[model samples]
Target: MAEVRAEMVANVWKVVVNEGDQVSDGDTLVILESMKMEIPVISEDDGVVAQLKVAEGDVIQEGDLIAVIE
Candidate 1:
């Protein structure tokens, strides 16, 4: 399993994948808004999304768990 974590504090602007969704490396799983910029959180490996730990409009801190892939 792989844990996808936030690299910076930001508000989750959009969730692009849901639980059980298949994703490839570099696929954007979520988009976060910070300092008026849109930052895309991407998958680091090819796998199925096992969990989603955040939602749109949620504020997340750096190192916070974003999703789990299996």
Candidate 2:
């Protein structure tokens, strides 16, 4: 299993995947807004999306666990 984590503190602007979804490397999993910039979080490995730990408008800190892929 692999964990997708926040690289910096930000507000979650969108979630682009759901549980059980098949994902590939480089798929955009979420979009976050910070300092007026839109930051896209992408999958680093091919896997099924096992869990989503945040939602739109949610605030996340650096290193926060955002999702699990397996």
Best by lDDT: 1
Model 1 over residues 1-68: C-alpha lDDT tens digits? 99999999999999999999999999999999999999999999999999999999999999999999
Error of 2 at 45 (Å): 0.7
Give the C-alpha miss distance for residue 1 in model 2, angstroms: 0.9
TM-score of 1: 0.97
- Runs of candidate 1 with Cα error greater than 4 angstroms are none
Tell me the tens digit of each residue's lDDT in model 2 across 1-70. 9999999999999999999999999999999999999999999999999999999999999999999999
C-alpha-based local distance difference test score of model 2: 0.96
Evaluated against the true structure, the overall lDDT of model 1 is 0.97
Model 1, total clashes: 0
